[model samples]
Target: MVCKLPAVFLLVPGIFLACTSLKPVQQLSEEARRGLGHFHKLGYNYAETCTMDCTFQKVRTFTVDRRLNCECASYQKADSVVWGLFRAMEQYWMGLSELASPGLTSYDLSAPVQSLHASEFVSLSEGEVSAIQKMAEFAVNTSTGRFRSRRILHYMKDADPHLRLLTEKLGFVLEQNLLGLLEIQQEEWYTHYKTQTINSELNAMEKEWATEKHYQLVEDAEKIRLKVVSLVAMLDLIAEKHHSLAVTAEKIGSENFRNITAALSDELKDLYVVFEQVNE
Candidate 1:
């Protein structure tokens, strides 16, 4: 993308205005917004691919109901749940970004937020719960007319735990369930086609065709695997950076905090560049 964020993130008009100097907390939240968007899209596709491949792999034997039960239904439900999780996470980050922004001061601010809740998919630490609650209490106070301070400590601190919880669980799902399913499908393709290559009933052209299809499956699965691996790494990076910001919450505009956020945004941008190159 022109801004070195994922295409998913760039689709939003001005979340990361390169010309504007955003506070450390605002910058971090926006970076995370990009990361979550890109990963969520990949996860959505992975879920569908997993279910579809599993269904067709056993197409010759299972009844429609059996196929749905064995393959499609669980992943379909998982997909819906995952979508909800990502949607909530995205909104949380966007709200935080708005909450922490400098330009939002004295703006016509009503409660631009709903009551945010913790999702069932993740169990937050006691520290996380306390932190978010503190932030929420602060937000309620600030809604009277205008936010009096620019110190983003409360909001960043609030975001620290939820960000970690959400990304950690999302990465786990991508690695354990979606990636695992795709790898299994890729292996099945290899084995099935390899066997067909030697089948006495198949002519040379038939074997060649099977080999080509097998290669296509491998190539496609490899792309998904690479993307999942990249996203998992990105999740870890963002969570760790957010934790650093939370720790430095008291020193919001200090050189240390500035350095941390600058390094993070650069790293994230570099990663997105690498991602685009790979995808192309």
Candidate 2:
């Protein structure tokens, strides 16, 4: 008996050829993708700001330490946590950008609106969707890892009760002395820092000015007293934003996304308890 190709294959000549289709892929909806990009960018902006504020606070604390001849290692440690949190956030945004626009090779974090929000939606392949899901999980895991390492409660133990008081004092001083200066002098600080090329002379001048300002602020015992308080507020804001982002990610993601981010949820609960205690 002469064997022949299967009847079905004969009827459809290329049906069993195992060729990949070149058909266009469906793109993610504009609203959904824009929302995702918005939240991702918002989280990233907050993280970046928190990092800068925390680092400035660290330097201020060190200035106080030197002037008063005391140790503020706890506050310094807290700053380190802030740095780690921002680093994790950067990674999260990168992962999110890759997920939302797999074809794009680079992301412009400073862009007012990430290009993901362009009118044309980017198509995601099946493999890309699966990769996106994995990336979301990784983002959540990294967030959890950053929080776990921070041990906020321990660092804030001696500092928490004074947060409100310090906030008030520092807010007043900042409003009186620094707010206008910041607005006028550093209105473009963030943008300039990212985009500008500073010569060594300009860098040295900025360093000198910063050093003088740090000493002046430390000379005011009230500011020094409230340094940790300011740090706590920054920390709280960052933690809150991080928790919100994780929740948003969970809502827009898969069942596995929820499971992977459960740790972040639990950590937020624990953080709330600490916040409540601090408030009391």
What TM-score goes with each of the models?
Answer: 0.68, 0.21
lDDT of 1: 0.65
The local lDDT score (0 to 100) that residue 253 gets in candidate 2 is: 36
Judging by lDDT against the true structure, name the best candidate. Answer: 1
Error of 2 at 51 (Å): 18
Off by over 4 Å in 1: 1-22, 43-47, 58-71, 107-151
Clash pairs detected, candidate 1? none
Report the poorest 10 consecutive residues by lDDT, candidate 2: 20-29
Clashing pairs in 2: none
Model 1: per-residue lDDT, tens digit, 1-280?
1222123332233322222234665777788888766764463355577666757666524546633644456667777766665677778778878866765643331232122223444344545544445444444434421232233566667777887888788778877887887777777777788998999999999999999988987887777777777777777787888788787664654678778877877887776765555576
The Cα error of candidate 1 at residue 76, in Å, is 1.7
Off by over 4 Å in 2: 1-70, 102-280
lDDT of each: 0.65, 0.36
